[model samples]
Target chain A: MQSIGIDDILDMESRKRAAFINCLSGAKATNLIGTQDKQGRTNLSIMSSAFHVGATPPLMGLIIRPDPVPRHTLHNILETGYYTLNHVNQDILSAAHQTSARYDKDESEFGATGLTSQFVANIPAPFVAESAIKLGLKLVHHQELAVNKTHLVIGEIQTVLLPEDAVADDGHLAITEHGSVAVTGLDTYHELQPIARFKYAKVGQPVELLGE
Target chain B: MQSIGIDDILDMESRKRAAFINCLSGAKATNLIGTQDKQGRTNLSIMSSAFHVGATPPLMGLIIRPDPVPRHTLHNILETGYYTLNHVNQDILSAAHQTSARYDKDESEFGATGLTSQFVANIPAPFVAESAIKLGLKLVHHQELAVNKTHLVIGEIQTVLLPEDAVADDGHLAITEHGSVAVTGLDTYHELQPIARFKYAKVGQPVELLGE
Candidate 1:
């Protein structure tokens, strides 16, 4: 076993520490955020920090890093107050990962990566035509973390587009069935193999495992 | 293909909507957050909302639901200012999921679920003895999501314990090598199948694929 303390983490090189600490929280969902500046030029960037905020109003939260790195996606989301989240499946994994490259503001990632961007229902943001599952959200909450200045942006789900068959009768979205992959650290992608699904958990009672 | 709008989502039953919308953000890391009240009674709860906040100071964030749900984990963190996040692996998957059950205030989930509680380095919280990877963090930043009152708790990593061999030479942690799994929606846990790791993405340069 290995034991590392705070001093050990802080003493390491920046990128190495980033990689070490990044994987500590475990696997994260990889999504390509689609946004467009006020002038309408589009931007696409990949993020692994998206998390469920709540369900009643269907809110999702994303953490955007502060300056020094590219801020196009965060910029466009704040500029337009709307953005799209497109799941990065095997079909577009490489292209989706390429969206993280630092591109000039004048260039659109769609054109750079050869991925098509489709405008749907007048959402003012583009959706990855190759993505299996897509989400259209309106920025409903934004606040900066005092600890790091990274932005915690929460959005309300306005639209969700996915294959009808992928949605089970009980409303469980069969994401892995549609090729959606999970990400770890900063750049590794993994395929998800279904284990079993359990029914709503209750105290002292065994949870009934269900099939996908 | 299915297209769900906000109105459609709001019209569905609460639990169904929860299942539907929870999958939108993609798979999340399932972790056992261990904390203890001021009186030293330990509490352990399963959480899927943990996300990487940043790496410079080594911060991780967890979104805790407001009142209605059991918040013993959140309450203990607030009360003691320290908590431990232990990765959920196959060995403890069922026991980990079982921790979500509503337990008596005096009953520790660790005892009820048969998971061992091991206190390390005077952190004021217990670490899951069975977790392959564990972290001790101090509460650093916290705020409520004005949208739904769900609290966003950020903690700084103070200590880390893991198997030495799971770390790659380039600093990426090979989590799947340690039996860690990812979770979708609420109760579905999936095994991670190694796909490939990509080098740091760069504009116009073809990213190099690295093997685990």
Candidate 2:
């Protein structure tokens, strides 16, 4: 294994290093399009760096910067504790991408992007009507990482929405049948195809060559 | 708003419905993945369904179930107070998914999947060499979420490893370049892509609109 000194590591700039680490970390390839409220008005942001945290209570999380500068969605969710995670497919990818714009507070990205909002049950937040799959989240905790200027928004899932046909009997979801595109690195996006699925097996013991 | 009875809401068997509503109520999706002992014997489970309990010390967490399930990653890190977040990517997506299996103590998924191991300074546990990015972490606090069922593993990042080219001049990471994937519901994976980048702007309210 190649060993490098910690002093050599700290020399790298934070943001520049964050971008590089994000790529190698495989977290750069996300498209977690979301809609949140600002005083009852809605705003959208396309977050592509989200992943699962647990499954028992079914939790999920994503990191958000303080707008790189305080934005509406961050403000709304933190204050009200509610938001929606809408999946971006080929149909809404462009509009979903456009949702990342720096629009004014009264502005609605749903209106600007031409995506429809579907009201979730008992929640004021609306899900993207165009999303292939959408998950509603309630903010349980928020933390600012001192190591980096990033906000980790954690939520327990309340409702999960998926195209009926996409769900397999064995509980696997086939998202690609609907044609979803994922962010690969920084500027690139790619459509996904299922390579293979294997039975759940225990990890096997390593075989050692005895008479070599 | 379309109001549905709580009982009616509970009647839905769809994972989306449950995940969305439960999340909307207050849960945030966040976690940390941990590795095993000094010998790099075990690759444990994921943690931190509780995203941020504290910001001053930069705390992150994960909720892990007890054994008979064989979560080596969680056991090793908690015992040694060290682990690494091996960001899941397309290259090792299958292997990362496989790690969730109920493997035996003698088995090593790292070997089975052909993923290499690397070390970070001062941490006994090893990081995934094939990982596009890895964060070396030190356990800050470990607590039980509920009785006898789950655990909340919290940690502070001590060091980070990133690829050389993934960092950007403006401090933005183009992680999708490394082909990362995000999980949803219970066991579904999606690829990621970056469509566009937007400016982070501040918000202003009009008193006239709210009659303030």
Best by lDDT: 1
By TM-score, the best candidate is 1
Q: Put down candidate 1 lDDT per residue, A108-190, tens digits, no spaces.
A: 99999999998888599999999989999999989887899999899999999998778777778988888989999998899
Local accuracy of candidate 2 as per-residue lDDT tens digits, A1-212: 23323343455555444333333333222344455564578777777645555444556667676545457777888877888877667776656666666777778877777888788675667788777667777787677644555666767667666665554444444555655555533334455544343343245533222122
lDDT of 1 by residue, B55-135 (tens): 999999999998675688889999999999999998888889888888987999988999999988859999999998999
Candidate 1 matches the true fold with a TM-score of 0.97
Candidate 2, which segments miss by more than 4 Å at Cα? Answer: A1-10, A27-39, A54-56, A140-152, A184-187, A203-212, B1-34, B38-70, B85-99, B106-122, B127-135, B140-212
- CA lDDT, candidate 2, residue B44: 42
TM-score of each: 0.97, 0.68
Worst 10 residues of 2 chain B by lDDT: B203-212
Instruction: Please give the distance, in angstroms, between residue B12's alpha carbon in candidate 1 and its true position after superposition.
Output: 0.6
lDDT of 2 by residue, B3-23 (tens): 333344455565544343332
